[model samples]
Target chain A: MKTILSVENLIKKYKNFKAVDDLSFDVKKGEILGLLGPNGSGKSTTINCILSLLKFESGKITIFGCEMRPDAYDIKKDIGVVFQEVAVFEELNVIDNIDYFCGLYIKDKEYRKKCIDDAIKLVGLEDFKKFYPKQLSGGLLRRLNIACGIAHKPKLVFLDEPTVAVDPQSRNNILDGIKKLRDNGATIIYTTHYMEEVEILCDRVIIIDKGKIIASGTGDELKELSKIEEKVTVEIDSLDEKILEEIKQFKNVDEATYNNGILFITYKKGKNNLSSLIDYLKKVDVHYDKIYSERPTLNDVFLYLTGKELRD
Target chain B: MFLHNLKYSLKTLFKNKMLIFWTYAFPLILGTFFYLAFSNIENSEKLDIIDIAIVDNEEFNNSIALKESFRNLSGENEQEQLFNIKYVDLAEAKTLLENDEIAGYLLVEDSPKVIVKTSGINETILKYVTEEIIQNEDVLTNIIEEKLNSTVIDGSIEEFIQNVREDAISMLDTSSLQIRDITSKKLSYTMIEFYTLIAMTALYGGIIGMTAINQNLANMSNNGKRIAVSPTNRIKIIFSSLLSSFIVQIIGLFILFMYTVFALKVDYGNNFPMIILLSLTGSLAGLSLGLAVGTIFKINENLKTGIIIAFTMLGSFLSGMMGITMKYIIDTNAPIVNKLNPVNMITDGFYSLYYYTTYNRFYFNIISLLIFSLIMIILSVLALRRQKYDSI
Candidate 1:
């Protein structure tokens, strides 16, 4: 796929601290690229620098095969940014807010009107076309914020933590609306700290820490970087240390530990780890109500690579 | 894009209840309070004819000029009467003074002497009239002595005396007492409150302009961030927003002007066109000052508003909004302070319209306000021209 946006050796700084340090990445055409990081991890700064909203000390930002600058109007018109914070006018109703923002990029009144209607429908704000922002709930307001940002139907969109602080249902709705945008042949750059959101939406993921990309690939490919293959958990009232040692001696068993009336046995590789644990517990007359095995997740991969959880 | 931004900026400003309260409702409320506080001044200034007594003594009869001055002051023309005089004997004059039925009693001896019960405006007026009559009496006596000494004595002496008396009274009458000047007039002293209120209204545009500029600055508001990243030129957006603010400011000022004119009956004099021009220019100065504060402060909206209010009230205080003496003191000691202050410029403009026949002072104020506005605009544009921020 053709690359739609690229940043090379980007460096943004405050008075003395670097906010985005030597960052380099490329977003493919017509794909949802997840930019994930923890709090204070340069996610917002990187996006701001890419949009030319911040003064970067040194960098080359190319959009549509041209160098991006502060005065790059041609590049800016095709881009839409839904900031992490809601940015809709409290004075304007749903439809007017969308129309005002969309008009900046699409001047034709007829086309702008259609775009406004399409944005309202896309964000499921059809019932709130005339309601002011202050009258809307937090989730509905978030949807309106998204509509204002993407009403002009730009070719490239940046959604920065768009579903933050929203209900589960609203989150699902937002995720669905974003997928629809992707299906309409528009590229999206999504930023969030939620690992599950990234795993669900991103065609490719870039995980950063300390202003640097630490990992990038498909979710499964990244998960493969984790050292542990699978883990078997058993819910039991009590367990002896000698029994933990015995579980550790099983085939390909890495370690076993018991805490809070539960037993956990980690494995690097073993197809029958759960079955073997079940058989041993049955023979030993150890009472266990539930036993299950799970594969390593993206968070586990992040922890293995960065010595911390994705949220930490 | 500029028009789109402008249209929404108008809607945004109108819908902002807080901005409306500060810029429109609050100033009107202040003006109403000012009117109520000053409503009694005109009534207190309208004076009734001061009742005075003249002692009917032989010396009073001999003093022809003093007697004639009393008759003229107590004349039958009720509208312009300065006094209502009673000719009575000494005993009757003493009774009137004791009964407090008169401001004072005048007795003519060597020169006219005034005796009063208490010191007040009416008593002061009686004393002032007696003193002026005595002065004219002395001048008449001096003229007759000079004529007798410098001319040949003949039967024409009586005729010459009559000529001197007529000439002296005529000159005194021409330059007579200004007692009637104390009545209610257009440029009353208390009207300074209204003039400064108008000036305050003009400077309240600063608050409107400040709020409007807040919507276009990235660090100030989240909407500003959205605007910053938009394809529209930043300068165009600033212009549209400021223009919208100016319109809103003028609407607020017009409401105050109308309320003062019809409801409170403030006489702004016969310079309506000049007043309007000064108001427009003053409001632009206010708006530009607010824009400058908004762009330069880099603080939150509330703090910036506080700063504008602090300076605006300071300007108004120096311009006689609180007390006219303050403006007098500043004009005497530190004229440059008010010379550069937009509030003072606006107020002086109104004062010129009320008091001066020439438009020199009014024109000077209008030009000063325009220059102040230009400086503020240049400063604000300097701060606003940057397309990118170091931190947001």
Candidate 2:
């Protein structure tokens, strides 16, 4: 795949603090690249540096095989940025707002109108064409913001936590619309702290912490990097410390803990881990409600890699 | 592209009702209040007639010229009369002065003298009249002395005295002080208040300019961030936004000028075209000042707005927006401040239009305003040249 954006050795400093420290990444064409990080992990700073909206102490950014600068209007013409904060004009109605932002790129009036209409329909704002930003709810406003940003149908789009503070329904609508954009042949750089969103949409994920990329791979590959192979959870009416110690002594059991009415067990690597736990429960005559075993998810991988949850 | 950006900016600004209220409606409302407050003051003060007591004595009778001057001053037409003269005894005249019933009294002895209880406008006029009478008498005495020594006279003493009285009265009528009254322009003090109010309105365009800057600078707002990342040149965006703000502000100023001139009946001179031109230039200066301040600072929008408003108020205050005498006070004490202040320049431009027949002062003010605006625009563009922000 062709590289749409590449940043090499990008360093952005704020006085004594380095916001983006020697960050290097590339986003390929026609793929959704997820930049997952906690707050203040330099995701926004890095994106801004790539867009030339920020000044870096040292860096090189290239878009479409051309060096990017503040005045690189040709490269910027094909780029769209949807900020984490909704950035639509409050005084302008939905249609006019989208048209205005689209006009910034597509100057041809008739074509721009069609693009604006398509964007509005894509964001499911057909009923709110004449409604001002203040008149719309938070969810509908976020949709309008999305429509405004992507109205020009740029080939490269950066969606920076676009679903932050949005309702579940609107979040799903936005995600679906973003997927449609990707399927329509637009490369996307999606930034977020939600692991599930990356799992659902991103083709490749890069997890960053403290201005450095800690891990980058496909979802299954990241999961394989974690030490935990499986997690077995059991709900029991009563459990004794002797059984819990014996369960911990199992050859594949890495850790076991009993709290309240549930028994939790993590395995390093094991086959039939659930069956082994069930057999031990029966032997100890512990009455149980239910038991299940699941493979390690991206959340476990994130925690194992960074010692912090994605939401944290 | 410029027109396109300007079109959307204009639409957005017009839709901002709060900006509309502050820029247009508020000035009109305040102007109405000023009209109501000061309309009757000039008319009520016009009815006052100076009261003076003249001592009735033989010395007053001996000086026929002084008595005739006093008689002529008390004419049949009340509008023509300079004083309401009361012939009374010396004790009574002193009593009138003590009781504050008369401004002063005249003692027509060999050398005429005037007395008053305290100093005031009426007292000052009375003194001028008395001094003129004494000076004329001295001139007549000197002329008679010179004529008697030079040649013999054929006319009677009474006829000579009458002739001298007529000559003295004519000389008094043709004096520079009387010419000042004949050619005194109709000056309305309330007009200054209206001019300063318009100045304040012109400076209020700064708010619109600040809005433009806030909407265009990358670090100022989220909308700014989006625009900053767009393909358009930053200068183009700044220019278009300022042009849109200027268009809106000029329209607001025009409406305000029309309301003040027609509805409030403010005499902003007969030079309508010049007035409109000054309004446009003044509004531009105000807008440029706002743009410069907004671009130079990395503060929040509210703080920038506060700074703009406070600066405008300071300028207006120095230009006599609060009172008619403040402009004069500042001009007298700190003339450089008045010369540099944009609000003062705007008010003075309007004042020169109405008060002067020549456009020299008016054009000077206009040129000053243009220079001020140019400096602000240049500074704003320089400050905005940093397209990439260290932080947003």
Candidate 3:
């Protein structure tokens, strides 16, 4: 498929700080591209640059092979942006707000009415058509936000944490709606800090840090780049000093820790590592609780790449 | 796209009913208050009579005609004509003046003079009317002297009368000698017309406030942002706003006119068309000023408040609340600046009623008002052109 959006060597700088430095990516048609990053990792800045809402210092951005500016109406017509913060006319009702935004692109009143109805139905907001923004619940507002952005059926949709504070049901509904858009041959740039969401929805993921893409691949492909393979846990009553030493000396064992009568072991790279750990545990004759073994999740991959710490 | 934006704009305006009520309803309410206040002033009494005491120094020795004229001043059919005379003696007249029953006493002597207990009343008219009556005797003496010229002999009595005639003529010609010059009565005008003019101004100004806030809020919404990003330029946006404001203001002005003419019984003179023309110009000027202010300010909460206060002050000041004399001062001292002020044009439009019976300045003020509106709208467009919404 052809690329719907392409940015080359995008560099955005403040007075003395670099917000987006040497960042580059392409969004192909009919694909859900996940832009996963921690807070303040220049994810919002990058989205803003693509939308032409902010000017970058040195970069080339082409939306449908045209330069974006104040008069770039044609290019903007095929793009839909739903910001993290809900921006809607508080004075207008749900149907009116959707109609207003849709009216921007579609001038014919007859067609606009049909589009408005379709949008309301798509977002499951038919019951609250006459309700004002302030009267709606957080979930309903999020859905309304989506409906407003996508009412015109743009070819490319940018969702910036669209489900940041929504309930589980609303989150599922939003995810399903986004998938439907991609299924209908529209490119989507989905940004979120939630790793599980990225793994579930994105056809391809690009993990970013410090305004640079650290890794880019599918879920399994990203897992292969991680330094640790498997993690095994053992519920033990008491760990002897000698057993701890022997476990540390085992081959492929990178680190071991014990807390709350559970001894966790991390293997550098091994498939039979969990069985070896269980055999060692059995030979030790240590009383324990339940034990389990699991492969590395996306969160572990993120921690290993960006370090295990919270950032602003 | 332009109509689409306007449709959503009006929808947004109506959806915020509380804002609508405050913007439109408050002005109408305040206009009603002004109408009532001005109507009260219009219905007030004018041209009241002044109280005075009459002192007859010659008792009943006066001529019958003189006695009748004096008695006529006492306010009775049998003895009433000029003044509400008390017909008191000198002592009683003094006592009456002291008791405050009369403002002063008229002394009918060889030369008329007024004696007052104090200088409490407007003595200008009193002195003027008193001297005017005495001057008429000189004119009669001139006629009598001319009759003496037809005398058969040139005796001392004829010479004496002739000498009196010459003396009267000379006395009338002297600059220092005071004459009794009768003051002409003024026609009483109903206060309703003045109240109507005032009501028109207040309503016009109030509508301006409403439209200014409307445009300000229109530019504040997301739809407003979306419109800016559309192919329709800033000029079209301003044009649409001005058109909307103009239509609404005209409706309000029409309602105010009906209320004043039919309900309040205000006769806007025979030049009804001219009055309407002035009203239209005034309202447009006000509307333009409102829109300009809205366009110039940042689209935020405080714009409405600021525009309302500024439009009100400017409109009232130019609408002649600064008084007619001040208007003349401004017009004469700074014609260019005064011409540029829309409120001044509106105020002058009302004043045109009194000067030119046929509405001479009607076209002049309308054109000036239109020009003022155009300038304001141009400024607003320029201001909006510089606006670029980079982010929140």
Candidate 4:
């Protein structure tokens, strides 16, 4: 796949604080790349730099092999951006807003109508074509914002928390629309704090902290890089110190903590470790209530790498 | 793209109906009020007759001689009832004079004297009446000279003759006539001035408080940013805005002009087309002024309104809309500012229609408005060139 967008050593500073520092990434064509970071982690700065909305002190950004400048009109025409904050003309209705943004590129009225109709249908805002931004619900407004940005059928699109502060139904619709965009031969750069969204939508993910990319791989590959191997949870009516000691002696066990009648254990990397632990528990004559083990999730991988909770 | 921008501008304007009402409708209503007040003053002044009271205290059995003398003395034609003249007793006259029921009272005595409670006596009536009495004195003098020649032992009438001559001479000069006429004629632009003033008030009122539209433009996908990024020349956008402003100004000017012509019945002179042309040109100045102001001040609606008012009042004052020759010093030295003032150009344009039978000054005024408009448009475009959406 061809590289749709490439940024090298992007740096943005305000007075003394560096908003984006030494950030480099490449988004290939026809792939969904998730940009995952915590609050104040330079996510917005990086997106702004890519859009040429903010100036960078040191960086090389090439969109479709053209240098980005104030007059890079052609490049801008091919690129679509949905900001984290919902930005649409409040004066215009959903249909007109979509048409306006689409008309920026496709000037032909006939073609613009087709594109607008498609965009409206894609975002499930067909019922709200005549509604102004003020008249629409929050979730519906979010859908209108996404429809405006992607209406031009851009080769590469940037969705910056497009589903942020939306209801579950609207979030689901936006996720579905984003997946359809990727499937229709368009590359997408998605950013969000929702780990589940990234796991469900992104083909690959890049986790950044303190203005540097700490990890970059597919979801499963990044999960493998996490220090956690497996999570084992044992539910019991009550737990004695002797049973805790026996569970601690199991091989491949990393750490164990008991709280509120549930024993949580983290094990080292090993296959059949859960079966071995269960067999050992049976041989030790400990009455087991229930046992369960599962692989680390993307949330676990995020917490392990960023050392911070996802929702914080 | 032009349509789209205008559509959104109008939409935002509509969505905020209260804003549009204040910007467009409110000024129109206020303008109409001012128009009525000023037109009423003009109409009333023309139809009003000055009330005069004559307190006849002299018990003259030979009043015919006095009346006949007045007819032949003054050569200037006199209307029989120039002053709404009424004869009354001294007490009644004094009471009416004090109460302002009568304009003034003339007490005829050995020496005729007048008493006025107010200083603002009508000059035209005063001149006509004084001339009539002077003629009466001339006839009285001729009769006295005849009587003296025919009779004997009439002691020197020198003191009486001297007083009579002095009174006649005093009444002939009537110096106040020139000053009073000039003031009244100069004030003739009341209706025209009011119309232009309201047009300007409406324009500035709208332009100044148009915060809602400005804010919407600022928040949008950056019409400024997009123009900057696009291959489409930035000059086109500026031109488009100027063109749109020109359109709006024309509509405002039309409303004001129509109101003056049809509703107020103001005489715009034989060169009616020229007056419209001048008004249109002046509106360009208004538009440019609005653009320059909008560009310089980047904030919310309240600040925009305040700045608009400041500029409007400054322009109106310097244009001499508030008073005549108050800005004469500025008008002479800084002709550009005065000429560029939309209020001044509009008022002066109408004045040219009234005073000049030839189109010489009218042409000059039109050219002045045009040049002023051109300069403002150029400066506005320059100011607009640097316009960008700054984050607030």
Please report the candidate that would top lDDT against the real structure.
2
Q: What DockQ was computed for model 1?
A: 0.53
- Please, what is the TM-score per model? 0.81, 0.82, 0.67, 0.69
lDDT of 3: 0.65
Per-residue lDDT over B69-125 for candidate 3, one digit per residue giving the tens place of the 0 to 100 score: 344344344222335666778899889878888878777676566776654323433
Question: What docking tier does model 1 reach?
Answer: medium
Q: How accurate locally, in lDDT, is each candidate? A: 0.84, 0.84, 0.65, 0.65
The Cα error of candidate 3 at residue A132, in Å, is 3.0
Query: After best superposition, candidate 4 residue B364: deviation in angstroms?
Result: 7.8
Model 1, C-alpha of A198: deviation from truth (Å): 0.5
TM-score of 2: 0.82
Q: What are the per-residue Cα lDDT tens digits for candidate 1 across B266-364? A: 888877898889889988898999999999889999998889888988888898777666676577568899998888999988887776555766798
lDDT value for model 2: 0.84
Which lDDT tens digits does candidate 4 get at residues A190-284? 98878889999999998877667888899989989887789998876677788788778877788888898788998878578888877876786
Model 4 gets an lDDT of 0.65
For residues A10-48, write the lDDT of model 1, one tens digit per residue: 998887888788999999999999998888889999998
Query: What's the TM-score of chain B for every model shown?
Result: 0.67, 0.68, 0.52, 0.54
**Which pairs of residues have clashing backbones in candidate 2?**
none
Error of 2 at B180 (Å): 11
Comparing 1 and 2 by lDDT, which wins?
2
